[model samples]
Target chain A: MTVAVDIKNRLGDFSLEARFESAGRLTALFGPSGSGKTSLVNLIGGLLRPDQGRIAAEGRVFVDTQAGVFVPKHKRRIGYVFQEPRLFPHLNVRSNLSYGRWFTPKGERHDDMGRVVELLGIGHLLDRRPSHLSGGEKQRVAIGRALLASPRLLLMDEPLAALDDARKAEIMPYIERLRDETKTPIVYVTHSIAEVARLASDVVVMAGGKVAAHGPTAEIMQRLDLLSEEEIGEGGSVVDMTVSAHDESFGMSVLHSAAGEVRVSGLGTPVGASVRVRIRARDVIIATERPRGLSALNILSGKIASISSGNGTLADVLIDCSGQIILARITRQSCHALALEPGKPVFAVVKTVSFDRANTMSGVKPG
Target chain B: MEWLDLSPEEWNAVRLSIKVATWAMVASLPPGLLIALLLARGKFWGKSIVNGIVHLPLILPPVVTGYLLLLTFGRRGPAGAFLAEHFGIVFSFRWTGAALACAIMGFPLMVRAIRLSIEAVDRRLEAAAGTLGANPIWVFLTITLPLTLPGVIAGMILSFAKAMGEFGATITFVSNIPGETQTLPSAIYTFTQVPGGDAGALRLTLVSIVISMAALIASEALSRRLGRRMDLE
Candidate 1:
């Protein structure tokens, strides 16, 4: 599925001007609160008409101000999951799930109720009231309801924002499963960086009601200079790896990446399972020569790809280890001492203890 | 015990009161719902003016409202003339005129109850329904209407009760005609004006109180049931 949106609208004191196109399964709009992420999703869902813009999903025109073509929201076949899980209070869970199906033409109904119920794990909630369900359960049911509509595009605006950390963790996997299993393209809006890192195949970074950057998640996250400028300090590169071996004696897991194998702290997953590990630039240390003695467990040799100036006194060093990219944040003094420049060989030193297992997630397919 | 028995005229008054109240409530329901939806959702020019017009009966004296209705719907008036010529319908000095007066007097209460509920409905839910492929009208019928059932029931009950007690408007518009326009309130008023009529008036008063109390209780019970159904979702 493909979605193209170019819209300009002005609300009181807030002006939204955004344009982005993506064919990714899950394209996340990541930004701070009140940055117009929700507004962008609303525009795509036809909940809000832009003062000037053209929106087309799967080659069907939804809104085109210049052409005076405006399709109402119901005809657009776009499903929206609001932050509050706005379920119809008068209907039971089953009825709410089926409410959307009534509008779908009989012959055009493609989404099976059994599949959606199983996908969201809401089978047990079919007869229960929405008020009786937990917050996580309500969101699951909301998603199921939207899916049953057989929408070509789904817009999820912070579906987990109101949940606690445990609830968010509980729902994230289901969302991930939806991303992998369903062919429907989704535009997910959120302010949480971890959520974007875990779910977004494509990332559109929004700041101050404008698109700061948009690209493949890995490439966008690796641009530390731009991310730091926008106050996204935790932004870093993601590497796809697989569990090559597990050393029970040392309590460590060996992960094989495009660059090379690196040893990290124990991961619960069995060998051969795919994992994505995030290595923050701030946690990386650069060495001029191979370290003779150090507690750091893993080090990879690579050539400096580029050096970009960062906020205040810091600088970002980009390293290319076979085609994989790693970022290191260093001071100008350290750069001068190492005489680092493009084509200069350096060793990227990463502490195994600094590799947070909690931050590490599995199920990323290798390229 | 003696006051419990009603004479023929008192019985006719009681029956006319029931018919007038029922007709009035049924006649005003559709328009009340429409006006309430507009007042709750429409963003149009002169919305406040429309709101004032809907509420005018609440603040205006019943006699003045009755007079306005009489002038507009009288046999010689434009609306009355057109109706008489096209449909052979008549309201002047008839039981229908009495029902019309009661409906006008009770309209404000009905609209207010419905409008409040409509305003309290979550707009986000409507938007969600839209994304789920239900059109706006369908959303209102399936979501908005069911959720606001308690308010609609309340409005209907209030209008029915108001219509049963209508006196000044009914009298001014249709006059007191035995077996025709005279309802329970007007009957009680006439009985009180004559000597040796206290017992008859007391009987009708008791009936009126019983009907009003029953309606209020029924509405309360119905609203509770609706609330539970809505909470299921």
Candidate 2:
């Protein structure tokens, strides 16, 4: 376990009560805005005190309300990267990265400045002041600064909310590299399901300041009953696959998965590279039999395991393709017209492929 | 250098003005910073009262302020009598008294400049530093102080300029004594009062204008340079 939190707090009309344990190196606090995602991480980072409950990271107790123990933020040894970069304007890039190192006890210091600079690709930015850097560049320096402090846990509150699409694309790999290189656990807060799908190993879904669901990233994503339609948009299934082939002419890549080989629009990875493909339930079409001459590029056959539709307009059809589970979002009329039922055989037609833009991107795996 | 002509007495007055202003600026800096921090961050009882008292000299007439200072710090007053007896220091009828009066009159301007700057600092930056294992004192020194440097500089220069031009308070508290308490402004006042004193008065007046302009320009350039380096407006 990396971080464990159980706390309750109230602010005017909003009441926050949450309890969850994170085992993954990169655990995500997944929720919509005002769901207490930031507040939860803030409590973990010691920026906000909990009215009651205990918080511990790596077995060290940060707060214990019953015991009347409260630790201030400075002693918590947590690194927080805010939505804004919040870099010291007076200091240059190198100095900002080392600002926290000066406060860390020597024994706990992580003095791999060379590697941090290299990891973030900020070699040429050391001498430049923060005002001179772009938004994306400032965020990179902020992350590096937090890492250099040797924090026991790193909390990032929508660290990329300020960056544009191109800049977000530019920085995602560095974040991946950071996760791979550092041993410190990360608690990332984000509302974007794409970010949670690609970056998180575990997901904690929050709604209205409460933990709606918590589990492995794959399990949580596939839990149709536990997620709203907004959260389930094109993210119903996360297929773990490796890059099997790439077609430069068509700008496509093929990914090999347990269910089947999936072909999509772009494969940014080399051959034999792993990628996570998010298959939205809505993008899946159900067929009683495999159809021919269809424009859909990929189809997987499986047995219908369950059919759940709380409302008549929409319902989720769970299909077990080989050993992997996939979801199909279909209307009640089609479900009734197709006479869909559990244990029945069917085919899942994926209209398109979506890819998580990381090392594991399957070319055009359904978005 | 033809415009720089000055007699020995005028030169002494110019030097004394610089000395008194320097002393006033230096003596008020620490307290100004402290009060600014308090007004920016403190949550205590009677904070408004403290604020009012700090700005009293700014709103009061210079002579009235000087009279209040005399009432509290005269030779026979509680603070003045104790200091003279124990530390052998005197404030009444001396150059130090002029410096003291000037500092009092200029205190509010310094504190107000610094307080506004401190308030402008982002508290979130300090919180970020705290998360990085920086204690409160460390955060203040590394983040708050450096970020507010422009304001501090502005405050110091303002106080210094005010001290240099101070006349009413200095005259009332210390009297216009040549070679002692007669600063540039006081000496100019004295020169304008007697027959055939026009040349002397003009010389000191020109000197005063040059020094004041130089101080203003120097401060503007210094703060601008520092603001550029720190990326502050």
Candidate 3:
């Protein structure tokens, strides 16, 4: 495991008992605001001392209350990217990026300043002060600073939460490159499902300061109870697909995945680039027989594997198509009218235009 | 020229006042910053008490504070006796005593200014530094101290200005002596009390006004330059 956290803490009246192990290079702490997502990452980063329990990474103990082994944040060798850029305003961009290098023992310092500056594309911003940089530039510099520290694990607590969608997009490719190319593991904290789908290899879902679910991204995304009503209320599955072709005349790109092929609007990386496409459970429609002449452009035939027993009029149906699981939600009346059950063959329909560009995360290879 | 009109004795007073104020301001800077950090970020059992004691000079009468300092730092007092015996340092009726009085009197303003600036420092930045492998000391030195430069400058200026005008505390503690401890304010007070001293008093008053304004302008310019360097304001 790259990171392991089995800690219990109490802040005011809220109690957080989070226990999970992540083997992926990028592990996401997924939850809504105030669900202890930031707190969990902070605990791992040694920013906050847990009242009880332990936090270990790759067998090295960071925080173990039982042994009274609580490493101070500076000595822990864990870099943190906060929600705000948190750059030292008095220092210029180059100095800010190298601020952490001042503390790292020369022997442990491995990341070259030039390499990091080039990676983040901040070489031109070296002399400029943090105040002079835009929000996205500041965040990239912050990440570069953390990388220069040569930390064992990087904890990013919603590093892009302070930026708009455009800025987030601007900085995401760097993080993806960091995840794919770097030796150090990263624990990213985010409340956005799109972020998790795009970057995370493993997911640890948090709710009410507890670990609601923990598994790989592909498995956790389709967990209806974890992301459905009463929880996030935004239930979806993230399909890892690669761009096979682009039809410029029609303004659409062809996506090939294990589940099926899909065509989405908007532009991103060129052909053969991997992307994460999020298909919301509610947006998927189900039919017992193959329907023809429908407005929807995509339809995948699969066998029903599971039907969620919902107290409401709606229920979620899981289908297995070519070793990939697809989720569809239909009303209980329609379920009974069609006599839907496990092992029954069905077709899942989704509109070509319903897919949003924001949901299409194009960076990093699928794990 | 006003500078040429001053008598040698008046010049000595002016020079001594500058010396005392400079010493007071410079000496109090480290402690003022420490106290400010303690008040701004420290969590302790007697935080409020420490805060109260730092601000005591501002609320208490200057004479009382002077008397208190005299009791502790006077030649025969316990602290004074220990210091004199160990380090041969004396504060009774010496120029040093005047600086001490000024520092004590100006401390509250100094601490207040630095504390406000320290409080304004985004603790998130400090935490960010800590995560970057900077120890808390490094965090304070590289992040907190540099960011709080404006406040430190303001505090030093306030202390220096307060020291230049300090009279009651210095008179009560060190007693006004022409060459030894007489500052600008004390010199003006002495000139006003003596007969045929109105001209001297007016000259010194105008001098004091000119010097204080210069100090304020210099301080503002220095702070603005530092602010520009930081690009924070």
Best by lDDT: 2
Error of 2 at A82 (Å): 1.1
What's the i-RMS of each model?
1.8, 1.5, 1.5
Question: Model 3: which residue pairs collide?
Answer: none
For each model in turn, which proportion of the native inter-chain contacts is also found? Answer: 0.98, 0.86, 0.92
Q: Distance from true position, residue A50, model 1, in Å?
A: 1.4
C-alpha DockQ for predicted model 2: 0.71
Model 3 Cα shift for residue A214 (angstroms): 0.9
lDDT of 2 by residue, B89-174 (tens): 89998899999999998999999999999999999889989998899999999999999998999999999999999998889888
Sort candidate 3 into its docking category: medium
Ranking by lDDT: 2, 3, 1
Candidate 3 on A204-311: residue-level lDDT in tens?
999999999999987898887777345444566777787899998999888899878887774556777777677778888899888998978889889999998668
Which 10-residue window of candidate 3 chain A scores lowest in summed lDDT? A352-361
TM-score of chain A of 3: 0.92
DockQ of each: 0.75, 0.71, 0.70
* TM-score between predicted and true chain B, model 2: 0.96
- lDDT tens readout by residue for model 1, A131-191: 8889999999999999989998889999999999888878887887788888788899988
Give the Cα error of residue B2 in candidate 1, in Å. Answer: 3.7
Which residue runs does candidate 1 get wrong by more than 4 Å?
A228-232, A352-367
Off by over 4 Å in 2: A224-231, A245-252, A358-367, B1-5
Better of 1 and 3 by TM-score: 1
User: Model 2 Cα displacement at A71 (Å)?
Assistant: 1.7
